[model samples]
Target: MKIDDLRKISVIGSGAMGSQIAMVCALSGYQVTLQDIQFESLEKAKALLNSQMNKRIVKGKLTEQVVEEAFARLSFTTDLKEAVSDTDFVIEAIVEKLDIKRQLFAQLDQLAPPHTILATNSSTIVSSEIAPATNRPEKVCNMHFFNPALVMDLVEVVQGPHTSDETAEITMALSKRLNKTPILLQKEISGFVANRILGKIMNEAIYLLENEIATAEEIDLACTKALNHPIGPFALIDLTGLDVHYNVRMERYAKSGDEADKPSSLIVEKVERGELGRKTGQGFYAYN
Candidate 1:
């Protein structure tokens, strides 16, 4: 199906990324259903969307009327069948676990319209691993959005082995419609492009910390001051959540059986302590 043919969009999961993605589509004049199992999570997503839109309006980035219109175009639901029954595209932004994703996709494959295209917002896991669980593998692909999807412009459009050219083309066009920069990946890799590079940087930073070569502050300072990165590895982890970083690393290590791919002891310790980044008010740095 073509980009214009896609009217109803369903975004699964109402976490930081999922809510923003649904808002982005709504802002672009698409009917969006933001789905999660918990009503409380959906309510929080609505509140977050309002706060984000208000911030944009205050900064003269979006008009109040536009925000209202976007809100009117959005809906929240807990029923999975109701969410995807009529949607032309489905974007899954749930947890990064493979089995969970596969199970969700399999259900979506059965619920969504025959023309629906299934996309995952996973930063590390590729679509091929999840597509095999569904019958419509050709219509399944990865549409990886960076954290804070509303702010991040770059989106990685990944093509799995079974992904159709039409699916890739339509997704690329849809990304542009949402005012995002889309980069196409011809082949599937675990972390794709951006995260692989980012993972390497974060791994080395953790290594430096583990070896006691420098404090987190010093390493972050070097990255920002010398390397000119906008945020240091430690700070970014705090923003992205140490648990998320650790989980992705563990997944990679499991797949590769490489000790170098394993998560840092520091990350493991933080996760074990439930000191997950900004959400928990603590990580490498304290938000509290």
Candidate 2:
């Protein structure tokens, strides 16, 4: 399938990644349906997208007319069937659970049109494992986007055992059309590329904190000054949220069977205390 062949998109789940993905597609001129099981979640996601667009307009990065057109191109609903009914493609951006993803794919298999390609925005789970459960495993592939999917340029076009070449090509082309950089993973891997590298740095950072090597502030400052990194691993983890980091780390660790992949006790302790970084207003440091 060619990129132009895809006109309508069905985006399942309306969290940060899903909502951003939908906004990007709509802005790129595709008719987008943002669907979630919870109506309230859908509402929140819609409002958040609007807020983001407003901020961009205020910053002079986006025009109000473009924002209006983007919103007009989007349709929101809680019903899965209604969203996928006429979509040319489906992108599943649900939670990182194997069973939950498979179930969603199975339903999409029955609901979406036969030619509709079903792509997952999963960061860790193997696309191959999730594809077979669906009716069109050949059409199933991974289109993993980073956090703030719309703003991020890189998109991992992951291919599994059953993934067809055409499916991969279409996704790659779509990424370009959406003004994103797309990298091809010839084979399936646990962490793909970006996350695998990120996971290692974070693990070492946790190890440092666990061994009491330095204060979190000191560690963050050193990375920023020495490496010119925008944010230190600990600070990034805090910004990304400890619970999300822990979950992705656990999945990758399980795949690699690496002991170092296990998240440090300090990380878990912070998450347990609800110190979820910028979101919770505190983590390794407090936010005013």
Candidate 3:
């Protein structure tokens, strides 16, 4: 279906990325259904959306009327079938587990209309890994959005071997309509482009910390002041959550059987201690 013809969108997760994506679509004037199995998660997402929109209004970035209209176009639900039944586009921003994602996509394929496009917001796993679970592999692709999806401009549009050109085109156009910069990848690679490079940097940072080459603060300062990075590696980890990084690394290690791909000792300890990051108020650094 054409971009303009797509009126309703369903975001099948209510976590950080999924909620922000739903809000962005709603702000762009699309009817959005934000679904989560847990009602508590949906409530948290609602509060987060309100707080974010209010902050934008206070900063003169968005008008109150616009925020109200966006809210009016958004709805939350606990039923997946009800959410995807009438949606023209379905963006899956759920957990990163391959089996879990495959199961969800299989269910979505049976629930959503034949013309509905299925996209994953996965950072490390490729669409090819998830497409086989469904019959319509041609309609499946990856649309990876960075953390803080409402603010981040880059949305990587990944095409698996089975993904049709039309699916990629429609997704690219949909990303543009949300006022994002879309980059299309012809081949699907694990971690895609950004995270593969970023994974290297972060692994090196952990290596430095592990080997006692530098402190986290010093390493972060080097990246920010010397490399001109807006945020340091440790801070970025905190923002993205230490548990998330650890999980991704564990997945990589399991796949490659490389010791170097395993989670850093420090990250493992932190996760065990419940020091996730900003969400938990502590990680490599503590937050107020």
Task: Say which candidate scores most in lDDT.
Answer: 3
Candidate 3 structure quality by residue, lDDT tens digits, 164-224? 9999999999999999999999998788888898888898898899899999999999999
What is the C-alpha local distance difference test score of each model? 0.92, 0.87, 0.93
TM-score on alpha carbons, each prediction: 0.98, 0.94, 0.98
lDDT string, candidate 1, 1-288, tens digits: 788798999999999889999999999999999999999999999998999999999999999999999999999999999999999999999987888999999899889989999999997888989999889999999999987889889999999889999999999999999999999999999888988898889888988999999999999999999999989999999988888888888888888999988887888899999999998998888886
Quote the lDDT for 51 in model 3. 95
Pull out the clashing pairs in model 1: none
Candidates 2 and 3, the one with greater TM-score: 3
Better of 1 and 2 by TM-score: 1
Report the candidate with higher lDDT, 1 versus 2: 1
lDDT of 2: 0.87
TM-score of 3: 0.98
Deviation in Å, model 3, residue 67 alpha carbon = 0.4
Which residue pairs in model 2 clash with each other?
A: none
lDDT accuracy of residue 24 in candidate 3 = 94
